[model samples]
Target: MQAPINIALVGNPNSGKSSLFNALTGLNQKVSNFPGVTVDKKTGTAQIVPGLTANIIDLPGTYSLYPKSADEYVTYDVLINPDNADIPDLIIIVADASNLKRNLLFCSQIIDLKIPVIIGLTMMDIARKKGVEIDLDGLERELGVPVVSINPRKSKGVAELKKIIDLAARGNYSAAPRDFINNGALAKPVTDEIKKAVPGKSDYAALHIAVNADELHFLNIPQKAAIKQTLQTHQFNKTKVQAEEIMQRYNRIKHIMKSTVVETDPLQKQLRSEKIDDLLLHRFWGYVILLVVMFLLFQSIFWLASYPMDWIEGGFGQLSGWLTSVLPDNKITDVFVNGILAGISGFAVFIPQIMILFGLITILEDTGYMARISFLTDRLMRQVGLNGKSVMPLISGVACAVPAIMATRTIENKKERLITILVTPLMSCSARLPIYTMMIALVIPDRRIFGILGLQGLIMMGLYLLGFFMAIFIAAIMKLFVKIREKSYFIMELPVYRAPRWKNVGTTMVEKAKIFVTDAGKVIVVISVILWFLASYGPSSRMQPLHDKYEKMIAAVPADSPAADSLDKAFRSEKLSHSYAGILGHAIEPAIRPLGFDWKIGIALITSFAAREVFVGTMATLYSVGENPDDNNATLREKMAAAKWPDGRPVYTLAAGLSLMIFYSFAMQCMSTLAIVKRETKSWKMPLIQLVYMTALAYICSLIIFNIFK
Candidate 1:
């Protein structure tokens, strides 16, 4: 049996760690959550040779070995604990060649683990373009490790790096050890005690125990008494001492880099990057560009998806009509047509819009412009009591709040991360778009608000801006009470401008779409089916008597008169719907009366919570159920416009429509978001809080709007 070698891929944040992992593992990677934590664990297998394999674990990105947040703590524990099931036999520390000074801080810490290690120097091309020269051989000699320069994005130098890993794993290579501390005075006493205790054990193991007293578990210490005595004798403050030693190693690494590395034109790249940054990060122009870009993004989602949405609506309507005509009219036929098929249609219409939005975001992220956005927005975010990293999650909140909350894992401060997660759901996600668009089209005038901005567009923009500012205000208030001492620094790497990677972008969009369709789709389908059954059948024999009376009345009408023909058609349609079923809708009619919604609308609201897009489908189904069998206009909007309240008012008045839009905008409606939040938060508590807060807010706001308008 051939044994697989374990290789741990470690790096600082934005050091091309993920890119290298993707390059090595390709399609073999799987993302899972770490045990008892929401932070992601990415693992994969790579073929080191024809037969041998390497199990690669891409640890969460961190700045140093020192653990700060929950996510970073997991990385430190996994690397330091030998008892871990997935302990790596060889550690690969990837570094950004352009940012060697910062990257080496992590490299120095990893070398202290005493494992066979290799350095992967990534972004060498970027470094070269900046006119920096690296003496690879000299740096290798100083670090006591093989250094392989790679461009993972281009698949350059990957093969050579793999060869170096193979050699290290096969024990065909050895280099002189790099020592950060002299330890001359301390080593004499430590060596004598180690000689007396273990008697000719490995020198590295002795040195490890001497320095890393906190890592006694990693050494598999068999005797507690002996370990205790050794620690007492050394007077070890393990964490502090280890940190001090790591800093010493970093100093040494910095010294070597200063000597071996040469800069031919140091100011050229900095001058160019700075000049471009000035305009992009300008206080006034930056805000203008951001607003314009966001407006364009929203417009693109609506305009681009219009044709496909119409196509889907028409296709589903035609299919349902044909099914009703072909199948025998019975409960079984009704269940299949109205229950399952209608449910599927409810969720499918929004696919085009979501796909377009996700595709655009992927391009922005891959092109590295998103990082610049974060930097540009840092000052404004700070006013809201959030760091620069909060910008990504807040922007993501526009598409969906669940993932936006999950994205807060990147924030190292516990309080800041928690605050971000709590407030992100306030932003209007795409789920709220259907309600907003429908109401805005009907209620808001298309006239300009200052002869420049369209009134309807301005209101839409104001809603989004309101939510964003509210999130900030809430975060700032929370920050005043939460006592946390963690320091934050803005040190993100600005990757060189490059064309978006089409393969990665496509893969991300497909994966996100699949997750939404499958996860949220399941909940919506079930809710739609249940709602169908509720609206189709009712209790008591009251409906039967009404149906019989209506039929008799229709039969008595004069056959040649136009009034008689219209009355007969209406009578039959009403009788058929009321027979055993429509009365149930009437029963719940009072419950939603306060919000100006009838029983049918109430049913739609309940089902739409599973997904907001289901609102249109529910309306379509309910209207079709009450229409004459021969009626041709199957459009929900047309049917809705024709509907009336008991007082003879239009069912969908401007006030009612606006109230509904506001309700959906504020509500926690998507089940998939709830599910993701549950997964990311690792408990029902946080998601439950979000659910309650958002739902209550929605109801109260809608109630106020409806009553005021009434």
Candidate 2:
């Protein structure tokens, strides 16, 4: 019944902090927002010793305690505020052994907080490859803390890491005997005053609060006032103090490094990663490799998911048909089989494709190639009013725009970041994949050109490329109109390449697949139920008369005759036409008709505003209601393909499918994305403009595409 031991994992970005967390926690981790903020807080439970558990928190990656962005602030707040729920009983700083100096800066800062500390050195192999070696015992002696070398990706030294964490949690560990910086020398008066005001805080913690009092939300009005007064009285210059502390720390770090570590001359060595990057980062070859990667990604989305998607569709169809057969032919049976079941199956078939897409993305990230993608695209990004950093958010938009917009926080230039946010939605996210897949199958042939590339896969790749191109084009246009003047820069480290961790990759696949099914599925199912009711029932007066007329006509015709079947089809169509959904669709048909969409598609467009993926579910429910009993086991794709207008033209022809794809590629149909934009931009102005411009663009492009194809 003892409380779980608290351990926090902290590090600079790309220092293997995430890999360590994954190795320690395995499947026991959960991700949620930190308090009221939208930033992700990842926590997990690990058994650190016999009969004892440790609650490990993986904090946001930050370079220093002084934060410049929202994500960095979360890390700083948790570390400094003892009252935080995630405040650690022990701190394990994961440092990159390959890049010791830069990583040590953050570690040195954390140590000065006087917390119990342990250094988990990662990338030992990479360091060795670079002809660098560190003496662990020497490092431990110099820093006066427990130091362990680990490779989290390979799960090496994980047991040793756990033992260290357990020992520290039980109070068997202490901080370095020597502080990295002398707080009194930096600002004796301010530090002394803060210690008196905030009892039990270390000199480093008190100093941090004094310098960042205005930005610290936990401090009360009186405490902030007192800190401000103390700073003024002492004439404490925060910038000067910080610069002095950094120089002093680096000087000591250099002395420690000379005695504890050895490195070969850079001119004598070339790393494997460097050799690989020579080709991958080459000006002309880099672009070619990037394109090939993207092409294969879209291709795999279809090729890998094909079998599983078929299984899901066939399984659901059979289940629906079985339910229809066992249950009596009644409205309740219809609702359960057609409304709810059909809705679930409609989107479930897409899970395999989503999982594969995320799995590949995770692999690219783990292998360190993802960073090079930004480096390669920096020049192109500049042309569109963005820097290399914006490439991450824009590419991440392929998975989901809500988090992608949040990722823009890493971009330092406000104007460039805003422009990136405004156009990110133009990238086709996974939510649109189902829509794209269904439409492409409806119109595009299954045959492959050149005997290797499937036409459907090619079309899918084209849509994704189109979306990316449109995002950049829109960003260019926004740059002209947005009136903020700011300089932008892109600075990033290219980590040494490593093999993808299969455990991490598999975990991501399951988590993302689960999210799509549970989160997007909820919206699709609820909307499908409502859509079913709207499509099934109308004004009682009209519905009753139509039903009565159909009964008489069907009764007059012979059973199993073509005439009877024709009359039955006519009657069901008439009933649906008089229904509420039909009325709504008809009302909007005029507006969308010029782009090759009809009343039914208009209904889908309106309902799918809840989520882009709902368009598939809407079609499923609509078609299920009027579907011939003989075709009960038909897939949604088959049903959509069979649909025809009153004039005998197919509803989802080549022109209409292409037009719809183009529209989704350009339009901002995701409400969640819009809400996130408003939250990030701090007003409705940017989101409104984004919506209007994207919608106008979608409509105009669809108009042109539909006309050209028709």
Instruction: Give the alpha-carbon lDDT of every model.
Output: 0.73, 0.88
What TM-score does each of the candidates earn? 0.84, 0.98
Q: Which consecutive 10 residues in model 2 have the weakest lDDT in total?
A: 263-272
User: Where does candidate 1 have its weakest 10-residue lDDT segment?
Assistant: 179-188
Q: Enumerate residue pairs that collide in model 1.
A: none
Off by over 4 Å in 1: 1-5, 45-55, 165-233, 238-240, 410-413, 434-462, 477-496, 551-596, 609-621, 624-633, 670-689, 703-710
Q: Give the number of the best model, judged by TM-score.
A: 2
In terms of TM-score, how similar is model 1 to the real structure?
0.84
RMSD of each: 4.5, 1.5
lDDT of 1 by residue, 1-710 (tens): 35888888999877888888988888788888777666778999998777679999999888877666666777876876556777788888899888888888777667755677889998777787788899999988777788888888888989998898878877865533754345333344664565456554334345445654444454446544565577778775656655665667667877988987888986846545556667766788977887876666666666687798889867877887788888898878776776677667666776776777788787877766777888887887777667888888988898788667777888877677777887888888766666676567556666765775566666667678767877787778778876557878656667655678787777777776786688667766776566666555544475567667766876787767787678766664564356433565566768667777776777677767667767766765676556654452365555677788757889888778767777777777777677877776677897788789878877788888898887
lDDT of 2 by residue, 1-710 (tens): 45787888999999999989988888999988899787888999987778778898999898887898788988998898867888888899999998898888888889989899999999998888778889999998888889999988888999998888777766788777778768666788899898887888878888898788888777878888888899888888889988888898899899888999898756538888999999999999999999889888888888899899999999998888888888999989888887999899989999999899999999999899999988998899988778898999988998999989988887777888899999889989999999998888789888988998778888998898898888888888888888657776788888888888888899899999899989999999999899889999999988998989988988997989999989888877887888999999999999999999988889889998889999999989998887766667888888888888999989888999999999988888889998999988889999999899999999999999999999
Relative to the true structure, candidate 2 reaches a TM of 0.98
